[model samples]
Target: MIKEQGLSVQHVCQSMSIGPTAVRRWVEQYDSEQAGQPGIGKPLTPEQQRIRQLEQENRQLRGDVEILKKGVGLLCPRAEMSFRLIDELQTKAIPVSQSCRVLGVSRSGFYEAKRRAAAPVVCKASVHLRAAFVASHQSYGSRRMVAELSNRGIAAGRFKVRRLMRQAGLKPVWKRKFIHTTDSKHDLPIAANVLARQFNPAAPNKAYVSDITYVRTGAGWLYLAVVIDLFSRKVVGWAMAPSMPAKLVCDALHMAVQQRRPGEGLIVHSDRGSQYASAQYQAKLASHGFICSMSRKGNCWDNAVAERFFLNLKMERVWQREYANHAEAKIDIAAYIVGFYNSERLHSVLGNLSPSVYERNMAAKKPIVVSEFT
Candidate 1:
């Protein structure tokens, strides 16, 4: 987790209230960490290091005192935080003198900071909750964030989570303005929109949607075609290439059928793009007994759910990046979908569950509800 976060040893020590030696000892256990990536080596002089430490301490103390003033009904939150840090560091085998200097703490006030008073529950909760928020890649908003906290045995009300998130200046990644990429003007046979915007499937693989989206790479443009199961919104399969073509969608369908093997008459929906409506793409779907459904010409809303998946893919990952080539974009987008989006990213439509988790729970229950999440 530390390697994934890419924080230096000193930051890790501060975040976990451990000493530098303890952090090194613990992180050395990670294969990625022990592999020795090149690290930034701007050596800080003693005075400069002291200044940085003072700034960090100042921020912590300011945050503590501000939280105390926010109707949390705690007195001297900074003092409480100081004592807690001291205790935690000591428990991890760090000397008081060593930690004090690093944290910009004063030795003369050590006894005063150690007052035996009960700390505010809210304050304690925030530390652990903040860690969880960071662990989530700052993707979870308050509702999902509350669920994440609960999973870690940190019980916090949704309102408190919202308030804390606002206070901490954390915000969920947001969707950008829309653009339609469907090319429905071609003179190709288009199937009727049999799916008809009915996005919530009763079970996995019963209904699937495919759409092509593009990312700007330095070389030119990289296009991606994705097949998503409507039941849980999981991207079952995807293919990325330098150009959008029938082969792209065909390859995506092949992978989807290979992985999921949806039974006969499974509805495969897409916009009436030439690629999707072409003989090659339709033949692949027919081979697997997939019932092809196309959105009406000039009507992207008929495939709203597929469009939404593309929106999220761009907003959460693609939009922020400037890829050097098709290969770079392909690798990054694939990792985003498989590594983070499918397995970990929470979806509100899935009742704050990851798509795979929701799918598993649905399989266990096996009940048909129109609103699966509700």
Candidate 2:
């Protein structure tokens, strides 16, 4: 009956009118003295709690060691990394056998993972494709991602890259609202259309583009203006101000002129915003011998290149980083431009070379051009 009803031993004993003394004596003798460590009615002391904790930690450590041993036994192969290890195998003074023992890996297991096999001429190609997939938000649909992979010297078709991306759990970023924040309707005087939508530059400092964009911080907003050299896409001059005004754009232009000292006939292009049209802004450009240019009314495409630069700047950096305030953002933006974007980051349009590198290469070819970066 007790078994059918799921009664515990204590309840079954009471129902059967049997004393628990005998069961208690049996437990005391058969069970370990350390069972729960409180013995009979005694309460556990702090020292006992500490002992229990230590025992649990020791057991966990033992389990971890066992798992590691199993993993070492399995020893999955890692191609190039294993080759490097083998090359260094006998170069050191220590015996290889002892070194293997110290490394906690069996010699046979190490060799198994290290043995050279026929290179996957095709698979290596897939890896390069995979890297592009990984970099492109991993969200590229099979066809586009595959096209991108194939374009980058990988021989794999769309199906293969798609399968690889799925296996690796990659996906491109979701499309978000395209924020159009540069408003040109202010009552300020507009600069005359000097660039006339001509963006092509034959050499460095021949044409420059300038624009203002807003960055959001925890405290509020920060406005940044940049003047980029059209020849190499380098940001020659930049300024950050609390508000967007004629002074904000002017400050950036001043810095660029000071650093590059672009001679007369240089084309400076921007939107037909009041700031750019202001007499002060036009005078500054005129004093530097730059021909001021403005985009056509209500046409963002007229200043498309400048707008594109801002889009890239936001997408590649500001969108990914968190800033506590304007000051923090300023510091990071400076580092991004001077330390990474100009000096290191590769641009596909610029033949996969950094802006600074492209500029340097161009300068080398045309030694007559005189320009300096501050």
Candidate 3:
């Protein structure tokens, strides 16, 4: 017993720290040393050993049946095929996380495949919504996407488009808040508040609104002066300059006059700025027989049409770009105003028609009348 246990009995004698009285009886009981040989099993034949190895391998291969069942229930597509291959690798005692890392598949994708398989419906609508969203530079929201899909002859409502947008993880670029940059602080002879938020014009050229907005550039600040026809809310003329001088406003008004050749008594509305109140600008307006109308002190709503135009310009174009200088901004902004905004973009107030289209439609609808002043 002592030999099989590999030494004993006298071990207690070596530990005298335990009092002799307590260990003395234990030593006396184990005093007799009975030796016994270590046991060894009989060796198995080579054939039996091979059989045992095969049984162990069979057990391991049978363990993969669970992974096989999961693969059977996964969604069928090229995306799921990738995950299916990952699952097969996982059955080989490989960690699922490790297989995901090796195959470059997110765990979310693996889980999403299982979810889709449970429902098993084709998502053609989501595909079209995703395509439209990508094509618009991700600028169209659910409402605009609904319109775009309808134009493509795909029947989809706003709510369905919104749902598909969420499913596809698609969202449009957000517009930053608009800032007021008009500086109306100047001592000059101002005109009476006549236009007074009367944005709905009876006809084109009856009234025009003007305003100035600032744009940041790498070089410095760039000022843009715009004159808009109140009837269609279209930018009739615009001028970009490094400084906001009276000549800036005059140049834009000059362009509007040259292009439209409006009848006499055209009321031009603007904020109370020195540029608009300057003798030079007043002389130019007088030369064209334009009646000057100014907004009251610090009242932006009086020139709301012009202010809205600037807001559209910034939110739709300028905010998305970083111009190196005024020249670059001029080219791009001119393209947006002429090529896109006025010609192609739809306005809800214009009944989803572009400004040019709306003007033509209005002209077709209304009969001509003599000038009010005449």
Candidate 4:
């Protein structure tokens, strides 16, 4: 009304019942709008107001486009990877919900990803858990998995390991019933249980346990004999053959002697199987000045360590694979014993250390004496 009537500012203020400053400011805004010039206050003209609205909308659209561009450019097939990108953008002042919306990701999922990333320990634990599980041939339970993580300097509790394992779908292989391969009905003289139930020895090569287990193959059953040192629970010797004969146990013991030449009177314990009680096996022990000890008839606990090893072998590797022939079974079983069991597998008895590592650590503390036995 003031602009069209050409009234003075003081007159307009008194007539309109508005303050002098308000009247003046509205007049200046109107003048600027009419002249198509920008002003500090809201535009009075419809065209100017429309322009201002469109400019604001354009700016908002540009921002949305920029966000979409970043989201699309960084987006991957995996949601986790995309969430990481969104997290990066968030640090640069981008709203997480906006980025998630543009990327077609749920806000909750993005936040979950953020929460996981916040815990580097959990992330690292997840990685180490999978690796340790795979490295263990999917045979490690939550307890051993936690120990493996601890060995790697990653602190993870059993419950946490179990949770992460369940989340990752890391289920260990189930164990089947153990098959008894020992035939104790033979006429061969059995050695007395001299070693008794003393499974843990103070020194390596002081006592050794041997056992034989059969593996199924297309060709036939392949027998495997292993000699474990009582001190380190290490497979000091192992031999595989298509037949379970006296020579098989002898060969395993021979390998054990070659690897660890124990002093005289070292106890060599085994179940009262015919192969173990055979004259050939007895002669082998006598030649090396070793004492022979046999488990009581039908008693498996006397050589429980060896039985446990066989159980582990079947559960972890043999049962998981299909062997076409003796050669295949032999190769795979050898790999499991050497590559995985002795070198990498965690032994609960040995404080979660691999057999090789336990031996090496112990040998360092007290150098193992290699006895001369030609």
- Highest-scoring model, lDDT: 4
**Residue 224 local lDDT, model 2:** 91
Which stretches of model 4 miss by more than 4 angstroms? 1-119
Residue range 212-257, candidate 2, lDDT tens digits: 8888789788889999888888889999977887899999998888
Positional deviation of 193 in candidate 4, in angstroms?
Answer: 0.8
Writing each residue's lDDT as its tens digit, candidate 3 over 203-285 gives 89989999888888898988899999888888899998999899999999888887777888889999998899999999988
- Candidate models: Cα lDDT each: 0.78, 0.72, 0.77, 0.87
Task: Give the local distance difference test score of model 1.
Answer: 0.78
**Where in model 3 is the C-alpha error above 4 Å?**
1-140, 168-172, 175-180, 367-374
Model 3: lDDT of residue 71: 63
Residue pairs with backbone overlap in model 4: none
Higher-lDDT candidate of 2 and 3: 3
Model 3 pairs in collision: none
- Pick the winner on lDDT between candidates 3 and 4: 4
Give the alpha carbon lDDT tens digit for every residue of 236-340 in model 4: 898999889899999999898887878898999999999998989988889889999999888889999999999899999999998999999989989898898
